[model samples]
Target: MSGPGTNGAAGAPLLSIEGLSAGFDGQSAPAVQGLTLSVKAGEIVALVGESGSGKSVTALSLLRLLPRSAWIRGRAEFVRESGEIVDLYSAPKGTMLSLRGADISMIFQEPMTSLNPVFTIGEQLTEGLRLSGATRGEARERGERALAEVGISEPGRRFSQYPHEFSGGMRQRVMIAMALLRSPRLLIADEPTTALDVTVQAQVLDLLASLRETRGLSILLITHDLGLVSRVADVAAVMFRGRLVEVGPVGEVFARPAHPYTRALLACAPRLGAPRKRLMSIADILAAGDGPFGRTGRSPWMPPVDGDSARGDGCVLEPVGPGHSVAVVEPGEIAAGAEPAT
Candidate 1:
C-alpha cells in the first residue's frame, strides 16, 4: 500500500467539506447545517458528536447516498487517485457511482445489517470488483487475500459461509475487508466499534490503525466516544446541534478544550480508579448554564440562529491557539458562548 505518493506529504486535503447542509423532504431545518471540515491523506480524523448531532448525515451527504426526497446543499471535494479533484455535490450520478467503493468507501456501523444475509461472503466481496471489470478468477483471489489481510483464518471456508455464521468481531473484520478491496484513498468508518465489547473494540481500533499505517489510508472516523478519539485519531472535530464547535489536534482539544460543550464532554468521561460517581449527563450540562466554565446564565441551549444562511456577524469562530478554534457569539447576544454578567 505504500507508494511514492502515498506518504503523508504536504499537499491539498484528500477530502474537503464546506458549508454543507442536508435536510429530508417536508423538513424545514437541515440535519447538518453549514458544516465544514477536512481530512488529509494518510491521517485519521475523527468526527465526534452525540446521536442526531449530524455526524452520520455529514458522511451520507459526502457520499451522496441520501434518498431522492432529501435535499443537500454544500461542497464536498474529493481528490481522486489520479490527482483530480471533483465536487461530489455537483458530480453526475454516473461519476459518483464509479467513485464509490473505489475512490471512497464506507464501513457502516452494524455489520449484521450492512452485510447481505442472502449473499455468501465471497459473493458480496466480489460484487464491486466484478462490476468494475475484474474477471471472476481475479476477483476470487483478491477477495480471499483481502480476508486474510483482515486477520481471518481459513479464508476459503469463510468465503463460502453466510453472514449468520460469523461472530460480531468476524463480521466487522469482513466489513473492513470489503471496504478495502478497492484500496480506496479515503474510508469513512461510522462508529466501527459501537457494538463490540471493550476488548474487541480495542482489537478493531488496532486493526484500523495498522491498516492506516500499512496502506497509507486516510480515515474519517465518526464516533461519540472521546476515549476512542484519544486513542486513534490525529485530529478531532467536535459537533453540536449540526454545527462544528471546535476542531484541532486530539491532544490539544482533549487537554484544553475551548468550547463549553467540549469541556462538558471531557468532564463527563469516566476516569479510572476514581470514585464511581454518577455519570454527568448532557442535560445536566445544559441546566448548569455556563457548564463547567461557571459563567452564569450561559446555557448550552442558546438562541437558534437562522439556519437558512451561513455564519454572519452574529457569530464567528475565533482562533484560541494554533489550529484550535472556538465558536464565539457576538457580545450582548444570548448565545452558546455568552459571558457572565459583571
Candidate 2:
C-alpha cells in the first residue's frame, strides 16, 4: 500500500488507508481485502470499479459506518487542518463523532434516502453545525450560505422547505452543501452523482472542483464512471473483487493500463464512435484469463477453485512505473465464477 501516507514526495496525504479488510458476520469471504490508498490535500483521488467491487465498502469502512455484524481490520489515518493525524479505525467513539461532521464529512450516494423526509433543510443542515458548537442563529446563516455555495437558487427559501420540495439535482446539491458546511478537511463522496442526469452530474462535479480550489478540501471520490474520473480525478484507484488491481495518476493509469482487469474495463467503456455491443463483463475477462495477461501472480486470499487450500496468496502488487502499481495475477488465481466452488 504505497508505504502509507506518502504520495511520492507530495507531502502527507489527507487520508491514508492501509491494508483494510472487512467481512460480514455471515459471509465467509471478505467484501474488501488488503485495500490501500491515499487522498492528498486539495486533490481528488477517485476509487473506480464495477458494482459490488468493494468501492462503497472501502468508504464505509473509513467512517466505521458499517453494521456491527461486519468486522473491519486496518488503519485509516486522517490528517486534520491543525496537522494532527488521527487514526479513524482505533479512535474512541467520541473522537469519531466529533470528526464525523466537523473534520471529516461524507456525501452519500442517494440524497433522497439520506435526507430526512420530515425535517426542513435548515433543520437538517444546522443540526450538525449546532452539535459542532455553533448557536442556532449562527448555524442557520451558515446553512443558507452552504446551500448557495452548491448552486441552490434560493438558499434562504429552500432552507425552510423539506427534502420533498427539492428536485433530484437540487437535493444532491443540498447533500453536497450539508457535507461542506462543516468546512471539513477531508470529504468522502460515495457515488455523489448517482441517479443524476449527465448535465446535473457535471454541475455537481464542478461544484466539488470549486470547493477543492476555494477551501483546499481533500476529496475521496468513489464512482464507476471513468469519464467522470478523467474529468476531475488527479489520481485513480481501480478495484476488483475487494482488491485494488491498479492505482496511479489518472492520465497514466488510463493511458497505460498494466493490470488485465484495468485493460478490460477500459475496453468495456462505450465510445461515441464505437458500435453498440454487449460489453465484456469482468467474468468474461477472468474466463479468458492468461490468454490476455502474461506472467500474472495469483492471490493467496482467493479461495481455491478445485477446493484445494494449497494456493496461498498468489497476487502481488508490483510497481510498473512512477507512482503506479498493478496486481500481477497469476494463472489459476482468479477461479471460475465470482466465488469459488465449495
Candidate 3:
C-alpha cells in the first residue's frame, strides 16, 4: 500500500530524503542532522564518510531498524515497483515487512557475522522465500538458482554446508545471493566489501555493477572508500560531523571539491603514481592558518566567530555546478580573501 507522498514521476528519484535527523535518547547531539539526498532509478549513489559520521545511522533510519531508544525525525520517500510512493518513516509495520527483502534488501558488512553459523547455507538462503509462502522444495530450488546466479559453483552442494565452511569471499557471495533472492528493486549495501582482499573487492563490486545493469537496480552504497566511490558510484554524497558537506556527480566532486572539508578528504586519499607525502588530517586542515586548500589566507570554510556555526544554522548547500552542491557559509560571512571560487 502506498503512503501519503508525491508519486514517482518518470525520471524522478527512486528514493528521496530531506531534513533527516536521528539520535539516541541520551545523546546531546544527533548522529545525523538535516541530511538530504536522492537516488534515481538505476543509479548507484555512494554515501561517503569517515567512521562515526552518521552514514550508517542514516541507512538504519531509512529501514526503521534502529533500536527503540533511537528517535528519528525525517521524510524518507521511496518509490515501489508499482510506481507508488511510500513514506518509509511512517509506513505501517506490515507495509515495511512486505517491502523489506521483496522491494528493498540490505547487504551488511562482515558477512561472517551476518550469516547464521548454526544454519546450513541452503536453509538460511531459502528462509525468506519459505516465510513468504513458498513451499520448501520451491524455496530450495530457487535458492540453488540464486547461488548459481552469484557465481557460486556446485550450488546444490555448497548450499548444504554451513557458513563457517566457506571462505570470506565465498561467504560474501552468499550474502549477495541471499539479498537477491527476492529481486529487490533497491539494494542498500553497507560496506559490502569490508575485509576482503583487493581482488575479491573488485569481484564483488563488479558483481554489483553487473546486477545494476541487468536488473535495473538502484543501489545505495554506504562506504568510506573514496577509491571505491570513484570506481563504481555514479554519484557521491559526503558527510562530515553528522552533516552532509558535499554531493554531486562522482567525476565533478572528485575534480573540483568546493568545500574545505571535501578538499581535506581528497588530500588524505592516496593517489596512484603520485609522489609520497604525509597525509593531512582533517584537524590539521582546520588548524592551518592559511586553510587546507592553500588559499592565500584562512579559508571561509573554517569556523567563523562561533565554532559550531560553521556546520550549524549558518551553513547551506550552494550549487557550485550542475548537480554539484557544497555546504558553505554566505559570501558576507566568509573571511576576506577566502571566498569560494565561482
* C-alpha lDDT of all candidate models, in order: 0.78, 0.77, 0.79
Q: How do the residues 1-342 of candidate 1 rate in per-residue lDDT, one tens digit apiece?
A: 221122335245899998888888987666777777888888888899878888998998888988899888889999998988989999999999989988999998776688889999999988988988999999999999999998899998999998999888888999999999999999999999999888888888889988988998989999998888887888889987777878877877888787767777777665667764465554554444352223532222222333332332244465666666665554455443333222
For all predictions, the C-alpha RMSD in Å is: 4.4, 4.5, 5.6
**What lDDT is obtained when candidate 3 is compared to the true structure?**
0.79
lDDT of 1: 0.78
Prediction-by-prediction clash tally: 1, 13, 0
For candidate 2, lDDT tens digit of each residue in 1-342? 131222354446788899888888987678887888888777788899888888888888888899999899999899887887889999999889888878888888776698899999899988877876899889989998889888898888999999889988899888888888878888999999988998898888888878877887888899988778877778889987778878988877888877666777777776668875476754555543442234333432233334332232456677777788877544566544423211
Error of 2 at 216 (Å): 0.9
- Tens digits of per-residue lDDT, candidate 3, 227-265, equal 887778888899877889889888888997876667777
Which parts of model 1 are misplaced by more than 4 Å? 1-11, 275-283, 286-313, 335-342
User: What is the Cα-based lDDT of residue 7 in candidate 3?
Assistant: 27
Better of 2 and 3 by lDDT: 3
